[model samples]
Target: MSATAVILQNRFSNDGATILSVAVDGRMVHESWNHTVSTNDARAQMIDAFLDLWNVYCEQGLVLYVSSRTVRNLLKEQQELFDGLLIRDTITGAMFRKTWDVCSASHHKQRREKRPLPSEIEKEPTPLVVVATDASKGKNSKTVGLSAVNSCGIIKTHEMELNSIFDAELSAINFALQQFGKNVKRLEVLTDSRQAIQYIQGRTSLQST
Candidate 1:
């Protein structure tokens, strides 16, 4: 596990990649590479590495800690692959500290200093800025809605109806990504349709009727 984590760290992008530490039984077993990659290819590779780490722990009957950033990225890029994966978001300083302590203890290392309060912790990690799109077919009309959110929740919702749900979902995702801008480091999209999720997963391409 240690070696696998080291390899993953090396493969991740250094500039933006979040550090991923893995441990079993309260012991630090692996720490991902320092590099950070934001491109799709990099995200795919990171997912692969994470799966490998997950399998290693599964074989040994141990639980692993995954960062919120990592979870969000995977949720966006490879939602299916992570469907049943045990993931916990370490967003609050207390949560982060607790997880960190678990990892440190796994390796027989002393726990590090705790971070500032949750309020003090930067809101940057939260997907405060988000766009959600949903589609439904009524007896005579189809409807689509676009909504925006910050830390407090939905700030705006727009209604429209495209020919298909795929169109609506894509438009919502695109709009959110655009609105959030490149400066935003994290974004979360919420949808209730499995078809939308599958479409994004590349299992099925969008088709217009």
Candidate 2:
């Protein structure tokens, strides 16, 4: 019997965003197009991202085909992360696993070797310190993870407890900023929690003006 593998297609939306679809031997699968969950650009919320992938993975295995390297990388990361998690069909609430292929092509690795990466660019380190923060639920208490990298190549990581991921995002940002105190004159903070940003910027309804 021939192995059943899904065929995939990639295209650009009018807004220039990537739109991905899967097909079985030329027949399109619309069942999932309408079902892709709004992850709110989920990064800190791995569960939300995982559920989006699980929506389709429970069926025939997925084989993603993409034109843009960026889209390919995003899909690859999504697939790999979902691969790590023990998941269930969110709709059916049944545990399962499925195969995933990331932009597979014949002699693809060998082809990539032809174009070696250029030497590191010579430049002074950036003036701004960049920090990324995230939070997630833990067994006992909510957990927060903070990572920071400076122009000088210095890196640091921190962890702490919080009431919830929502709270963690806010607390993590403050913890990250205070890690170096007033020493960081120029800084850039990165976070996955939109609500946290809204609250901090005084744009959220929950926050009073």
TM-score for all models, in order of appearance: 0.32, 0.33
**Local accuracy of candidate 2 as per-residue lDDT tens digits, 1-209:** 11222222222233323233333323434212111233332221333323454465645443333333444455566665544332222212111112123222312322234332355333444456777665556767556665654445656677876666777677767777776434555778788889999998888776321
Model 1: per-residue lDDT, tens digit, 91-180? 234444554675544323211212235675556544344545454445566776665554455465567777766676666666666655
Among the numbered candidates, top lDDT falls to 1
Candidate 1, position 28, lDDT: 54
Q: Which has the greatest TM-score?
A: 2
Model 1 weakest 10-residue run by lDDT: 1-10
Worst 10 residues of 2 by lDDT: 91-100
Per-candidate local distance difference test: 0.50, 0.46
Q: Kindly report which residue stretches of model 2 are placed more than 4 angstroms away from their true locations once superposed.
A: 1-127, 151-153, 207-209
Clashes of each: 19, 0
lDDT of 1: 0.50
User: How many clashes show up in model 1?
Assistant: 19
Q: Which residue runs does candidate 1 get wrong by more than 4 Å? A: 1-133
